[model samples]
Target chain A: MRLSNLADYAVVTMSAAARHCGGGRTSAAELAAETGLPVPTVQKVVSKLSAAGLLRSVRGAGGGLQLARPAAAITLADIVEAVEGPIALTACIDGDECAVDHTCSVKPHWPAVNAALRGALAGIPLTQLSKAAPREPNPSGISA
Target chain B: MRLSNLADYAVVTMSAAARHCGGGRTSAAELAAETGLPVPTVQKVVSKLSAAGLLRSVRGAGGGLQLARPAAAITLADIVEAVEGPIALTACIDGDECAVDHTCSVKPHWPAVNAALRGALAGIPLTQLSKAAPREPNPSGISA
Candidate 1:
């Protein structure tokens, strides 16, 4: 499974939002500048996030966008599902139809896998993630 | 993140392989017939699984494929990576460089997310999955 580039940008932009929560609106253009992401890309991410109810957008001067709810309430899974969609390890894991949808012997175990995946994602909330992180570009850079 | 359809096929086909394991080398044709998957698609899944060391293959009249190791030892993640390359939430999750790779603050978190995701996947071994499942297809049509 691969996360689309859009999901990555969404997380980055959301973190940017969290950093500005209650401070005032942050424009997608400014977020793009701060993160070095393309303005159009960040714009799309902001729009999608706003559509997902993760962000509340406002228009007019000094108006932009910010988190709709507390950062603590937003989980990575929520953002992912909003930017992406329901996480499915395999379509048959939760889909209504597949070759073995009815007569498959190993179908039940998939939901467990899916649930575990969701739980892992849900464990990470935007509140925790929005914290100012060290400038390290990769966690592995810390050197075990 | 979206799962490649190939990975889904691999899981579904492997389940079929594990099911017909005791019956001797199961051919891709047989898997396709049993699972109602396209023959070519099933063939690709089997070949990929074999290449990934998940399945052992033989040639000749009775030649076919069987699990390389007990299903218990294999996790869904292993199967997924075998078919899809890797489970990465972002381009740089593997420590690769992106255009804006140099200035991101949350690069540290990406790896944590990756690790968390991998850990969740690794926790689910096929052994547990196979055992939790009955040897036969369930009576009620679970999927739509």
Candidate 2:
């Protein structure tokens, strides 16, 4: 299965946001430029992320968006879900009654599979994803 | 991101195949009927799955498809990858040169995220997916 383009863009947008951590709040226009994503798409992502509580927004002069929590506290699952609802691989798992067949036997097991997939995404933190070079030693020896 | 429809259909088709495990080979037409997926779609899925060695095809009269190995040995990763190449969450991780911007600093960390997502899919065996109710004891207690 593949991620939708919107979801992919969300991750990219979030990565750009994480990179700006501690640098200062970033506006949607700035994020769009950083990610090279369309301005409208970036705004949509920012709105969704903000509503999901992953991002905090301040309006008015010099106001911008920032991560609501530390990057390390946010997971890919959160970013993905913010854009695409729960990280369900199948509609059946999301509680949409299967329209294919009433007696479909495979329906029952989808939840566990969905859980396993979500768990995997949850294991990854934005800190790990934002790090440019996790393996290389810090040039400044600041121990990031 | 969402799994492409093809990938989701592939899982449904394979699960249908797994249900017929000991009952003998099943043709693509039968699978189409069983899954209520279009015949052409089922055929396409069958061809890819066969090429990936997840399904073995027998030609000529009485010819059909069978799992290449026991259902327990097959994993969700195998089914998904068969229909949708690698289970990479991001195109950047797929080795495509990022077209967005050269200065995109978050590119490098995607591989780890991709790996985590794939690893999650890999952890789920087809047997788990094909089973209708994993927690319930079989009335026959035949040990599926």
Candidate 3:
């Protein structure tokens, strides 16, 4: 029903990283300021992405994080899975042995639904995320 | 990433209702037994389905529920929506804005993904659900 905020932050934080891709490792604090993300949250996002292998981290001075793979190769579904787990649209979709697992005829169809959803999410490459760079507001206080 | 149990119960209970489509109305108790759902859960499903105009419910002795519309016209999407509001893989797909709403560049594409998912779900008609009812297993311990 809702994307966890972690997933949203991952995309935003990753976009910030993409902007500084060739500038060597970028610090989490620097990314937070660039993307206007809270420091703690940005750090958490960095840690998760790092652990998920979507990002690789460096240590000591001149250290930070960068995408583990090219943006075009990563998908939104990957971000979602990094934040959450396998998409299980319904408990029975995986054929988990519950009392009514096999009895409910509708359960079989859920796997298909979950697949369709996953496919849709994966259809979007992360390169698309950086296509439209965040723009500054117009003088009237509206997004340009 | 999961279908609420309520939706599961609704789908199960509705399938049972379809099983006896021409055999007159079936009580919640009968459906519960047929589908192995909890009695109160079946009752709640009946109420939600009725409120959503998917089921016609009658009270008193010899009164129960029937599909409000023909099975051919109903889709899994309808039942899903009845129990879970709208089928949104993520809150962003539902157009609910949060603190970081303006900063993300990928938010616009999520709605397209949502539409694709909706299209997939809508493709499955409930009549197909009935016709493709899962068969009971054989004693050989193999799914039929």
Candidate 4:
């Protein structure tokens, strides 16, 4: 149940973007550098996020990309769906890909299950992702 | 967010096994035929499920495979974890795979998010997967 690499990168990219939100717009290259992701990958993610309405781009000097709305308004679900499609857990959700689809009982309840999973992701706002974890105690008394 | 093919097949295989509970013990071949999965795939899934203690195999005449526990006692989370390991959504959960892990804010919260996701899957019992959805209305009043 791991996230696809693209989806994972999208989360990291979005977090970087969220951190840069208040100061000014950030470019894809800057996001790539900040997240340590490749330029093409960040560009691709940026494009999809923009299309999904999670990001807005500005043109000309000092212009770049910013969250389409406030970070608090965006959720992990939104970033995931932007890179991937709707969060269906099974291919059978869309088509008769499963051989026993005709008689498969589990098929009927997938929507509710999917909704539950999506709800979990939806509960996490992007604002939460930008907040650092509390530092741990340093037993060595050296820099953490 | 889709389940791996093996994970998906595991659910289908388990549902078929649950259906055969009262009748008698079922074999891997029987499960394969019932779920429309190939023999080797069923065998592979069976081994993993057995290893996870979800299924028990019996020996000798009339002996085969059966659920280690009642279907109602099994949950989707058990099946998924059997095949996919822990349900961590990102690689950062285990190792420092992500480049921004050193100072990443979101890193601290993934455990909670993962637990929430697992809780959702855990809410669904295997018994639910074996029960068919209610039939739809027949406009022509014909057999559904």
Candidate 5:
């Protein structure tokens, strides 16, 4: 199953934020430029992320968005759930009404499967997702 | 992001087939009726599933389609991938041309995230998704 474009954008945006950690707060416009996403889309994602508490926002000058916690403490699951809802693969898992729920034997097993998926995403810390700082150019012409 | 509607239908159809294990072959119409999915939709899903080798089709009188292997041998990952191709959450992980790929620091980390997601889906055996047989009626008035 493909992740929705919105969720994909959220991950990209969060990755950019992770890179800027400790450097200072970043605004939606800045993140959009950093991630190459459109400014409006980045704003929507930023709003959702902030509402989900994955990001903390401030309105005054010299203030913007920053990760709510250390990058190491945040996981892909958090990012996904911030943009989407809980990591349910099926609506039935979220107690949504489904016509087949009564007759569908597979209903009971979805929770376990969903848990497995969430756990998988949770295994990846955001720290691992941030790019390493760019290395300096080699001082000597010869390979070090 | 949500699993596409087709992918969800695919899982439902396969779950129905799993319930009929050893019962004989089934046709797309039969699966549609069984799962309450529309006939054309079932046909499309069945075709994809067959091409993926999750279902084997036999054309002739007294012939239909059946699971390629025991339900226990098949995983949710197989069914999802059968309908939707590889289970990557992001396009970059598939090596597709992404405009932001060059500057995206998170690109390298997606493979691990994707692998985790696939592994999670792989852990759920189709057998677990099949409905258990209804318990026999109790002869006495007491609930058994």
Candidate 6:
């Protein structure tokens, strides 16, 4: 129904990182500053993103952080999964038995539903997420 | 991202209600018993679902609970939204400003992403969710 706060922050952090993709690398402090997130929060998210291979951490001089893959290759689903594990909407799908598991008919169909949900998120590439909002066209030619 | 426990239970509870559709009416206790959910939980969920108009409360002696609409007419999105409100994944989409709102490019496109996510859930009718799982085709004809 809703993304955890960590998952939401991951998306914002990744989007900030993607903006710096063309400029080479960015540090957690810079990303945190740009995104207005706390340094510790950014560091926590950065570590997870790094472990998930979404963000690569570079060691030593001139080294910092960079996306492990191209921005276009990353997705909302990927970022969410990086912070929240898999994209399953229900725990029963992951083998955690629910109270109604034995008699629940809906359980079998969750895979298809989950796939559709994931597909929706996957369709959005990080490249798109990193861009500025396009100005909406004005029929009257008046800019807001 | 996972559905809150209430939303997940809503799906199970509704699916149980759908099974008893032809039998005229059922109570929250019956739903709780059938779905193995606690009676209090079922009562709370039933109230929400009823208020959302997904379920109708029939009054009097012979009356109990029934689907407000046909099972096929109700959807996973409707059920989820009934309990969890709108299906927007991130809070920012609902006007809760995030720290990165001033520069977050992803914010503008969330409506499309959210629509797609909701569409996935909308595509699943409660009728389909209530049906028993189909037997998988046995290629070798070896029964387990």
Chain A TM value for model 6: 0.88
Model 1 regions lying over 4 Å from their true place = A93-96, A99-102, A132-144, B131-144
Per-prediction TM-score:
0.86, 0.82, 0.83, 0.87, 0.84, 0.90
Worst 10 residues of 1 chain A by lDDT: A135-144
TM-score of chain A of each: 0.84, 0.86, 0.82, 0.85, 0.86, 0.88
Q: For model 3, how does the per-residue alpha-carbon lDDT over A1-144 read when each residue is reduced to its tens digit? A: 455778778878887788777777789999888777799999998888888899999988877778899888889888877877677666554556656534667765666666777877888877777877423333242211
- lDDT values of the candidates? 0.76, 0.77, 0.75, 0.83, 0.79, 0.84
Show model 6 residue runs off by greater than 4 Å: A60-62, A134-144, B59-62, B99-101, B134-144
lDDT of 5 at B94: 70
Q: Which sequence of candidate numbers ranks them by lDDT, best first?
A: 6, 4, 5, 2, 1, 3
lDDT of 4: 0.83
Give lDDT tens digits, candidate 3, residues B28-62: 99988888878998999999999999999999988
Ranking by TM-score: 6, 4, 1, 5, 3, 2
Candidate 2 error regions (>4 Å): A19-24, A135-144, B136-144
The 10-residue segment with the lowest total lDDT in model 5 chain B: B135-144
Encode model 4's per-residue lDDT on A12-108: one tens digit a residue. 8899999889888899999888877789999988888999999998979788999999999999999998888878888877654675543777776
Q: 2 or 3, which is superior by lDDT?
A: 2
Task: Quote the true-contact fraction of every model.
Answer: 0.47, 0.44, 0.47, 0.55, 0.55, 0.69
Better candidate number, 3 or 6, judged by TM-score: 6
Clashing pairs in 6: none
**DockQ category of candidate 6:** acceptable
DockQ, all models:
0.41, 0.37, 0.31, 0.35, 0.33, 0.45
Q: Write the per-residue lDDT of candidate 1 for residues B11-118, one digit (tens) a residue.
A: 778877776777878898988887778899988888888898899999888888899988778887788889887677777756677778436656656666666677
Kindly list the interface RMSD, in angstroms, of each predicted candidate in the order they appear: 4.8, 7.6, 6.8, 7.8, 9.6, 6.6
Over A1-144, each residue of candidate 5 has an lDDT whose tens digit, in order, gives 667778878888888898787888888899998788889998999899899999999888878999999999999889898888888888876768675534777666666667667877887788877856422244232111
Give the CAPRI class of candidate 2.
Answer: acceptable
- For this target, which candidate reaches the highest DockQ against the unseen true structure? 6
